[model samples]
Target chain A: MLITNEVPDGAGHEDPGHPERPDRLIAVREGLEDLALGDELVTVGLRSATRLELLRVHQGAYLDELGAFCYEGGGDIDEDTYATYDSWPLAQLAAGAGLAVVDELARRGDGVGFVAVRPPGHHALPDRAMGFCLLNNVAVTAAALRSAGERVLVLDWDVHHGNGTQSIFWNDPDVLYVSCHQWPLFPGSGVPSEIGGLAALDRIVNLPLPAGATGDVVARAFEEVAGPVIDEFAPTWVLVSAGFDGHRDDPMADFALSSGDFAHLATWAAGLAPAPGRLAVFLEGGYDLAALRHSVRATLSAVLGDPSANEAPTNGGPGSDQIGRTLRERASTLTLVTAQRDAEEAS
Target chain B: MSIYPRTIAVGFDGSPDAVSACAWAMATGRRLEAHLVLVHARGLLDRFDRRDPRALFGDVVSELATRHAFNEARLSWHVADGDACSVLLRCAEAPVFADLVVVGSRGRDEHAGMLIGSTSLQLAERSAIPVVIVPSTTSEYHEP
Candidate 1:
């Protein structure tokens, strides 16, 4: 299911030469169309989230303040965040699209759901907008599912950790949040010890890699930490906070994950299931236009279980082995910590 | 007396650049016997929110404060709302007084270029105080 909105126009006005501009979505759509993915795609549009829906993951006062700022005409929401007339509504639409995708997938019984909305949401928190995100769409959707009696697992593979999502679910055992991001980077808060919510500490898993980590490092992280957690959780549903900013070509982050890595990860995720229709995905962050297109297409193809998805690019020699080893070590460390926590909880 | 002011106000928002600026401020604040004021603009938070930005900022400040032998009294933390440029400008223009301001070369989403970011450029353009921009790749901030 393709979930999108009139975000292209909204994003167009944010920053003219910015990397997170509307053209990124346009390029992805054009690429998918060129590849005829549209033939197999089912498109859907979403209305702006109601105040109640937003309040699930964000503070009402914060939402009010954001609206106030947006209504005031021009101001920066935070460092690296901007607001215009369209930003508030567009942010709501962006978040609403993610929820709409979850609802469609939950109702449809079978399909891959992708929300091509912008101004990414992973960095947003319960009360404020940061990292260009006004709302924590994935977190809100997961909360919605939990409220509806569905156990959820949120996997964030953005180059940067979904600190906001982790923060939101830190103490809740009902939702499992796992993220593999470049460490010593932005927000600098995803330490392994920062397991979530009181007494539910093991629910949050953070695998932080050193700078210059490559695709192999990320894949190994999935193989060692992320995949194992999902296998053990057996959650009722799985939600991916998909961010392609880890692409080797992406300028905003230093991780060197290739398009092939994204495809592999998506395909791997698609195979896990507590039910026939349990997995959903929402976009987060990716800057490089070419990498974003290729990565999204690769991920979509994997989600669709297409065997002929494009092969991993071979632009350079195999990535740094040392970094991969370091990432492996970090994941192992987190896995041990999580296991200990789980054991303690069981006792 | 020294030509450069001793007290430095650094702007941090948890980005790589922001972290670097914080590290720089810690070091510079120590060398000059000046105070380090880490100013971060808190985003809008509703009552239902659980995470505490002040606690997070305090963790970083306490870590640096202990390591540098700087008294907790000498460190100040401010959490405001709005743009980074405007916040920094306000601190620089405040009666509290600052000799210099430090920021990361590039923000979280900004690309590499001659100018760090629009906010940084604006801060440089508007501030009477000198500004320091540390590159994201720089090793100054990596040590624990």
Candidate 2:
């Protein structure tokens, strides 16, 4: 089910000056409406995430404090992040939407489910919320799947690194985490050398590009680095940390990706899943309203297998070639891991 | 006020023939003032599994539901993960759904004079309730 927090009360969690406002969801809903996709999209209502679900990815004390802060009329967790009286409920709704998508996909097996939620989650650490993120929505959902004994693959295509998601799964070998983001960006954590720790060396793959990187660089990184590793991992479920801030028009980032590039990346990533594999996309950080809407439509088109709906290819911005070459040259880790897995199985 | 307690489940795949079957179901649902549940089985394909059909056909379903909205009947949709026949069979027997199931006589490319398609045949044999196989010609009998 396509999920969104469409309730009128959702507006109470508002900060007019903040980029993450109620208008983001409005644009998403209107933009989807403009597409006029008949009988092809169904949206489910949002429910609040239970306290137990929040504990999956956040510290108990931090959760308690955050709830108390919100209930006490709310204030800033830090300079960039703020919470209102309704912020706690809205955040629970965001996290719950992700969990609901996981539940639907697990039961139905085949379907495209995306959550166009707010208060982006990739930057939120497990211990506390940051980067305008109140909770790690995708991390909580992934942790739930892990507890169910399902191997999961988290493909984060957001502009900034998915530091929180990576940190949550840093030690676990069952969840393969991959991210393609702009280097020298906020939170500054997605370095290639910072792959998984001692136990899960090759499980984490980071393809950090320069400011002017293009869609071609992202496509190549997926093909060269992510695809091979996913083929080796054979995860039972695939969850996407979809962030549209990488779009050329987005105000938040420096990446030069066009709207079509987002679709191209999603199409390739969707292929890594097994036949009829469940792909649940969690909305992260796309600040530009128009670009976000267009990118979401294009991504849906590609996922639904309509090539004609995708826009014509555009230039892969400046420095795209250098980034592609560098990733290809250093992408031996996935190959090495695949070969080892094959040998181990044969033995 | 919807007088009918039974909910009608129609097997739809966005095919022309399926559209005709939906029209028939809609007319019947209007007459009975029963809720309509459109079921599309987006089963597995060889290379990739079928994505949610609603992402592609939601407007069409909404339009159909609107046409019968005057009957005061609620319209809902389910895109299950299995093949059409089995999904329809399951829907027919489920407690939430009605015993009556509706389907197209034949899919897009089936013979014009054929009585039923493979899906319809399988559903007819396995369905616990009555199965209505509307032919492509039924489109003309209903109001647009």
Whose TM-score is greatest here? 1
Question: Candidate 2, which segments miss by more than 4 Å at Cα?
Answer: A1-9, A307-311, A319-347, B1-144
TM accuracy, model 1: 0.69
lDDT string for model 2 (A1-347, tens) is 23333433458777776777888877777656766776756666677778888887887877887787788887655435678999888898888887776676666666777877777788777766666788898888888888899888999999888888888888789899999988756555676766685568678888888887888877777777667778899998788898988888887777888778877877886777675637777788888888888887777666666632245545656655555554664466546655776788799
Task: Compute the DockQ of candidate 1.
Answer: 0.05
- C-alpha local distance difference test of each model: 0.71, 0.73
Candidate 1 stretches with Cα past 4 Å from truth are: A1-8, A307-347, B1-144
Best by DockQ: 1
Predict model 1's lDDT versus the native: 0.71
Docking class of 1: incorrect
Candidate RMSDs in Å, in order, are 12.0, 25.6
- All candidates: TM-score: 0.69, 0.65
B43-141: candidate 2 lDDT, tens digit per residue: 212002224677777777677667755342367786653346656887855544665788887754333322222568767877888889886665523
